[model samples]
Target: MENYYVFIMMCILLILLPGPDTAIAIKNTISIGKTGGLQTMLGTCCALLIHTSAAVLGLSAIIVKSAILFSIFKYVGAVYLIYLGIKTLWGLRNKEVAVTDERKDEDKYGSKSCFKQGFLTNLLNPKVAVFFLTFLPQFVNPGQDTFLPFLLMGATYTGLTALWFIFYIYLLNQISAFMKRPRTQKVFEGITGIVLIGFGMKLALEKAQH
Candidate 1:
């Protein structure tokens, strides 16, 4: 459908724009490697599914209606983003530290931790949920009297997320050798933290659309 293509194009443009999700992906990729980045992406995609379901089921409308509830989530998301930023920035001085020979043990911890981090980072952000609530409906034609369009939109969005993240993973893999340098990794983490905080701040200030 021509409308579907237009919707897809819009989604791609939105994804290409710099945002917390992209910043998180980059940060994870440079610090931990492709697996870490991919894991984070997977978590974000899972969050998207939850958001999509909320939107379709009308739960998001309830959230949007309750200013107190919405504000609570907004602040929580903001705090989490700021916490991540501070943590990353604080680690800047420790950049040159090498992965100890006990890296094998550390690696095990890192794998599970990375996956959780990825999932929680997106999951805890209520702004992302609100965003989908606001964003996805614009393309829907209520007159159609069919759910097929929404299904297509959801599939397209999921595919776009996967594709973009894959591209990020590939690019990060290519530069992973350089990223392994402690100083480089520190800078990368710092940037990621800052970007996430910025996104969080922006979300905190976002007013619910009427």
Candidate 2:
């Protein structure tokens, strides 16, 4: 029970940590409104669900053991991050913060794009794959006899993630009056672009340890 409590706390803190996923979510929320943010959250949750299942099925361990496979994943993930960073930076020039944009049919396409971005942004991140494989096991009960504990913990984390992002998007939307200002938008977008690029660089330099 104590381990379970610790596990929950650890997951909460990790999920709330500032990172590429959160930045992407914020960017989507501002660009396409709450629908964008919700789609982003959905994509990330789906990615996590897949990673958890992969871990359960021992696929994650297989990736770790094969250096070539791990390297491929790492480079793909790293390149994707850098690509996102560059794309976000490019969008800064055309900044039209949709806090007040007229709703249009085209936004559905944009939302689908956002979903793919979020999905790939999460899915391609090898660190997340490794985290699922390594981190949760640390908090699993030593005497546990069933896979039920992991399933429950993973589901809890995924649900918490959905709730957290929904609340986060709502709060950010409330600040449209402030964030919609041209200067404010520039400053925020500029920072997001830089942070994303930095994460990309970090990922690029990361090494996979077996």
Candidate 3:
């Protein structure tokens, strides 16, 4: 019981942390609109579902355990993160306007593309897989089957994530008009770009712990 409570608290705190996922949400919100943010959120949650299934099936364990596999997954994920960061920074460098009419992005990133964007962004990040593997086990009881507990815990975590991000999206929407200012837009993109690249480098350099 206490373990469950602790797990919930930790999950909430972790979800609140600003990371690549949060960066993606913010960037999408700033770029397109509320619809884009919602689609991104859906794609992100779907990816979490996939990660949970993979972890329950021991696929994440395989990736974590096999040094070669882990390296490949880690590097690919890292490169993707870095690519997004550089692309964002490069756009800013090239004087790309951060906030524009939705029509402009309609062709560049349609509604369907938003889903794919979020899906690929979350799917390629193996750190999320590693996180699910390492974090879920802490709450499992020793006497029971781990698989059941893992499923329930993963569901709980994912649900909490969805809940929090809904509020986050709402808050961003409330401020969208103000944040759309050109200066603020540049600052937002600049900060997100730096953070994404930093996370990429950190993920690339970090050693796996079994």
What stretches of model 1 exceed 4 Å from their correct place? 146-148
What are the root-mean-square deviations of the candidates from the true structure over C-alphas?
A: 2.3, 2.7, 2.3
Between prediction 1 and prediction 3, which has the larger lDDT? 3
TM-score of 2: 0.89
Give the CA lDDT, 0 to 100, for residue 93 in model 1. Answer: 63
Better of 1 and 2 by TM-score: 2
Model 1, global lDDT = 0.73
| Residues 63-158, model 2: lDDT tens digits | 877888888888888788788878878978765656335346437476887788788888888888788778877876678642666577778788
Model 1 sits at a Cα RMSD from the real structure of 2.3
- lDDT, residue 191, model 1: 77
Model 3 pairs whose backbones collide? none
When summed lDDT is taken over every stretch of 10 residues in candidate 1, the lowest stretch is 97-106
Local accuracy of candidate 3 as per-residue lDDT tens digits, 90-192:
8787554443554576546665766776777788777788899889988887667778788888899889988987898889999999877768878998998
Which window of 10 residues has the lowest lDDT sum in candidate 2? Answer: 97-106
TM, every model: 0.87, 0.89, 0.90
Cα-lDDT of candidate 2? 0.80
Going through the candidates in order, what is the number of backbone clashes in each?
0, 0, 0
